[model samples]
Target: MYHDYTEPTWSAQQLLLIALLLVPAVGALLVALLPATRSRLVAVSFAAVTFVLSVLPALIRPADFGWFAYTPLDSAPVPPWIDLDLPWVPALGLEFHLGVDGVSYPLIVLTGLLTLLCCAYTPAKGLAALLLVLEVGVLGTFLALDLILFFLFFEVVLLPMYAVIAGWGGPNRRAAARKFVLYTLAGSVLLLLGVLLVVTKAGTGDLVLLAASPPLDRTTQYTAFALLAVAFAVKAPLWPLHTWLPDAHTEAPTVGSVILAGVLLKMGTYGLIRVGLSVAPDGAAWASPVLGVLAVVAIIAGALICLRQTELKRLIAYSSVGHMGFVLLGIATLSVAGIQAALLGNVAHGLITGLLFFLAGTIKDRAGTGSLNQLSGLRETAPRLAALLGFAAIASLGLPGLAGFWGEAFAVIAAVDRGGPFWTTLAAVAAVGGALTAAYFLRLLRRVTHGPATPEVRSVRPAITATEWLAWSPLILLTLAVGIAPALVLSDTALPLATLLGIQP
Candidate 1:
């Protein structure tokens, strides 16, 4: 092993990037050791640093024609912004590889932003440290280039999120946490097995190598893809697997719900595109129809569930299932347009749903409830809050001028343009689901914000806190910005996605 292994070299930039990755974990440790009173300040300070590091790569990496394109060299599919390649286990051919590209850069920035916002919005409680820890996992998952490394980062997200829910959540937090653990654990088992299968067959755990020169044969790819699908779907929480999401979101504290929807759930769909499809195209193509069908069902089913929900938080939670459905449908198409749509949808949902959760939490805190039935006449009692909520709802419903529209519109276009009987049918069904989404949101708005104020609402003053405004403004502005100029995201993603899927560049 020693004879074959060579010590890896790192440049200053690579070392600095690695340091940035370690900052959150190091900060978490420091925060954990500090007095609880000072933890929030320290966490936020560290989060700000981490956020700067996250955005640095985009500036450092040159882009041509608005797309972050890289010529593959030494068999690397796309030149990672800062590839840290070093042998970890020579016998197994595993390396301590980390990097980021167009596909992951946006999400890394998102993780940083959301983490900072979470810290800012909440009191200087013990929760800030945990959020930082979760950030480490989320960012690492986006950056990891080794399959084993990716899996480790992916699992790191579980404990902190569970703690957040169980420790800070509402009445049903315990049960929700348990359900979340059970589902994710079950999914992880399958995912772990899949990783093993791929690595064993490929004889290496490096994601870059696996994609550049697929080592697994078609049969093995199919088996691994199937296993990975179950795991990712559970996290994506598609339709039947999505039961845990509503409970977790409804019970979780505001920041918990925001991060869960904004950053955590995207992990699953992102994994599908990055690992599932890139590593196993044949399997993905074979499974696309099934995936597409479930996606459409999730869209329709999630909307249908929301329509009947009496609780505001739970309804919004259910709405995520529907919103994520569009992301999944886009991935199933396996076309460049489809994957780009998925990526755009991911960011849009993060902005839209995160804002919704933040607002919902504010309403609950102010009026002492999250029940739509009791949340009447917000427009009359709290016009500003109602306006914000209304705008977020419209964005979520895929209004023409909102960020949500591009994702849904492109997903349908990808499906229809794929031009098979099955895909065309998926597009039609999803179009129907889009209408249902509008219906539920309209119903939600009419019930919660437009009606006459109830006695309870009248008693409580729904003043928007400075913290709420501070935390929500970025999300609100981004939703509008992305809506007006989707090219901000799409341009960067196009070449990379096409490269990943073997589409024409």
Candidate 2:
């Protein structure tokens, strides 16, 4: 069910949604055309406005007759707080349909905030412009309710990100960018096929309608889910499909990595919940066991890989695999608790990992190396940077009373809640993986911040920049805020998850 805003045709909410997409988009073009010196100001201003707009949807209370009001148990599964539907391609049976709800609103806000930070932090006009363009793609992906529109927005992110990596990255960036594009393009092909399959079979491309009452048969659902799952898994970069990630992270620039880890990867998990399970319940159930097994494998494998990594960025990159594994595990459970954990985990990972990448980039820039062994006793030289790194690492390790704890700890709990021999065992192994996460992070802290200061550390500047503080402070604060009160992300999610899982709210 959608909110039937009783306001006039061009309502405030409608314009707000339009501005959310349009502002950054126009900003990108303006930033590109403007003088190099003014680009940062223009980009940040657009991103700031976009971020502010992103939050308003959550505050707009539904009317008495809206979806949020008391309704029967058979309410629409994919209800949006605000939705806009307009004709696009009649020949393709596609409409320009977009909506937002608890499931996507958090991610939208996250994308906006991170992009704003990245734009502010980057000095290059081209990079800042690309970040804004990337923001538009990500926000559009979260907001799109039409299958074709979703796919279009999904593809829009690819080239700009490719340019970011290849244009401003470490050595061997070309190979990494090529791999990233080729790998994700393969997934995109699969995604297009899946979307077309669903549309052809169901004769419509509207996700809200399909999710509310799936028109596909069991076999169709199975095929659709399989295609969609692999496609999203590649983006999620689940386990073996994740080969592209560490390379991308290691080679990409600071802002690129932040966006890539922060909210870009989220498109996968969000798609899994929104498209995979919703469109094919039976297929998801059929595939749950396999998904569960792979998720646990990713958890253990990613953690174990992180322990052996020598480069700081590479280590942090691999850790995302492990963290995302927990998210996939939660989704595999297909319970209300499991999905909610996934959502919370998604937001948590974005905040904590984005900060980690930012800190890592700063440290590497100051010390002139990201090698864990070569860099030691950072606290002796750059206490502020080291302290921030320590905080981010601790948070990434899932320390309680921080943002990272809820998603990971509860993924295990949700698995236990799932309660079968296989699930129980998977839960146990995932718990072990969590232990490994802590071990590696402790090792990282010990290696980088605890020992005697090296020559590189000695030469490093101790002061933290105002720009760095402006970029990182929100992530640090939000990590604690969401950790202390999980409700910040989970508040609007319950009804949506319950509805998606076919459980009573």
Candidate 3:
């Protein structure tokens, strides 16, 4: 039943996903073609339109929704909601397909929401066009179900992002962009090889089919999974894989950092859950313990480093390492609760950490330096900004009232339930990691938000913009809403989660 829902059958809403891809592409191209000297309003408006138009499919009733896109040439018409197919090439047994069900719906929505936010917050006309094109790439990556196609969309996300950071970033932009691309390129190469191995082994590259009847023998699967895992692990920035991130975050322009932390990183964990767990459960089970230990190390190590950091952007960057550690913990558990917790963490981290970067960028944009020692009286000078930072920070510390809490709460609980010698030993370590997170963030809050006025205040005050608040409030609101009701995500995702975990439908 879950496989039936996800196959490449073209439904009406599924076609909307295609439109979601095309509309932004067209609009962004137009923006790019426009003269750079023109008012940036045109670029911003075009970007905004994509966000407004995205609601078309999201509003569809569950009953009306099915997944796929088709063309008249060799396939059926793309449905308004779904698309499915078993393609030709019997010799190879491969199918070209695409679809989305409830599990992927949140990411689809998040990509749309963050793209819109990116559109709203972007300042440069040239860059606005690039950002819109980037949004299309992201949306495509989320919706694609074909392995080869998915790889293409995944690669598409990188170029625009590379351009955005290098073209518009601070003084260190070139180095950051290079580092970001090098890491992602290395990951993408591994993903490509993994995709090739699966196709070569199983004679099909359709994600739906692969998930339904996975490719590769146990040895081959283990090898293929290592390639895929390391590829995604880099993107997930798990512990040692995370070094590229802090530099990227510190140097990236506001919107670049926003999208990077918000949507791009989740792509990795999403792939791990969707493709890795579903298609290579045995390998995933094999890798689970190692992932657990690393999770604890990342949580603890990231927190420890943050305690030593004086740079505000770098501190927030390290906090991401800690927060994402919870995400890893959830993935490592190999339980439904753990998977769900990882998903929860994905969404929460996007909201909370992305918000932190946004507000941190605002402060840095004002104060001339992101160094914590140079900052003081932020609350007095830019109270709204201080407030946004506080909300994002406390949430990062997993305060119960916000979105960040549930992923950790669920992960720790799941770890305990997945108990035994190693799991329990490591989970206890993760629990201690939690305390470290709280300790450092609280210290950061005091030093940044609760200090006497300094020369920075006069500078920070004048730069506060209404536009920043407008862009930030929605994320903060979602953080609060999801904290109160995580079921919105978990419920919709249950069937897909069950399928991935090999639970009976």
Candidate 4:
């Protein structure tokens, strides 16, 4: 179990949490009501404020108590840095609970930053408002401490994303949007069932309480974890459930793809840690082998498939399946090192993959085609773009000093730490998958960045735009920063993960 830092009275911390959700919510409305001409400025302003506010929570010190302060007899597992709880639908056993800690703070900031960048980059008239609305859902999902509230926030992202894709996406927008919705809705149904089961059985929707003392029996815990895991896997789009992602990325607009790949997919991995494992440790233990196996499968399958992909966006989309497989693998280890690596992997994937989509979108837009065969010799025309793409690809392939390396490398280390034949085999196979990851990315760079300039490449603009630099620079810098110093994401995570997993500090 963890400790709680709940306060009886409202404070500046509480106000900031409320504002994180409200600013986006209010901004969505204002963007709709205000002139479209001013929408970009207004949306960016709100997103910027929210991003700034999200960072403030991290500066608020965690309670002075250390992880070693607790004993095995104690029941405090994961503690919030700051939390606010109020009665909401008491009859339904729900509360208006909100909180943030080491685990959630990084993701909240990532969501805010990506939303701000997307808003700044997109010029579509009404899309800015929709992006804000999506921000509200994602930010709320990361903030909510109530299970029911989390579900509501999670659902909130569905429609706005559908609208973004269907309204502003490419030629087959409607079809891609339909598939995305259908697959996720199916996952949501399972997610809802799991939430209702846990709440009804435990008689409370407060996640902190549930994490501290899971009330379900072994059987019920197994059932709940299974439902939640499968539901999140759909969002994580693990392996076979990942088919929708390629099409969605292939058709959605650039900003839409950025948000989708950047922060939205994180909801699944976050839920697995916060809800599935925290609320049902026995079940997580029971299912780790299966989870580990499947994650390995996803890693191998996604890489092999990417090797065969022809379209640029579709290949990047498939790569997510493999990257997220590392995350899921880390979670399956259920060690402090594994979970910490999972969190770092989550943030790194967001930065690197988000940049990849941005560059791919720009290339597709300028070249008038996304086909790898028709796109070549990018360095001859767009040297800067090619260089950035090369950096992103290398980072995605887990280059030693970059953001992507630590999470994946540590995930394997954590598995080795687990020290069993089964996990050892999974680690070996996953290592092979890593090698395959490098192969496909190098193949991608060769096809898209090297070789002689094609007709499409010759016609493309060589200069990078101010908006592109504005949006991509931060990701570039952060990817390098996090890669060089992973402690940026991992510093606050140890205590929470240790307590949550019952591992001694």
For residues 432-477, write the lDDT of model 4, one tens digit per residue: 9999999999999999999999999999999998999999999999
- Model 2 error, position 273 (Å): 0.6
Tens digit per residue, CA lDDT, model 1, 285-377: 889999999999999999899989999999999999999999999999999988889999999999999999998998888889888888898
Q: All candidates: CA RMSD in angstroms? A: 3.3, 1.7, 4.8, 2.1
Best by TM-score: 2
Shift of residue 112 alpha carbon in model 1, Å: 0.7
Residue 377 in model 4: shift from native, Å? 0.6
- Candidate 4, residue 449: lDDT: 92
Give per-residue CA lDDT, model 3, range 1-505, as digits (tens).
Answer: 2322343333665566666777778778777777766525665665566565555544563443433211222222112234434464556554545565555667777777777777778767777888777787777777777777777888898888888889998899999999999999999999999888877877767666566557568987787878888888888788889999988888888888888888888888888887777667778888888889889899999999999999998898888888888898998988878888999999899988878888888788788888888887888887877877888889989999789999988898889989788888877888888898999988988988887967875588645567786788889899999999887567545545655666542
Name every residue pair that clashes in candidate 2: none
Candidate 3: where is the Cα deviation over 4 Å?
1-11, 36-43, 52-58, 61-81, 84-96, 462-464
In model 3, which range of ten residues has the least summed lDDT?
A: 69-78
How many angstroms is residue 464 displaced in model 2 relative to the true structure, after the best TM-score fit? Answer: 0.3
What is the C-alpha local distance difference test score of each model? 0.86, 0.90, 0.77, 0.90
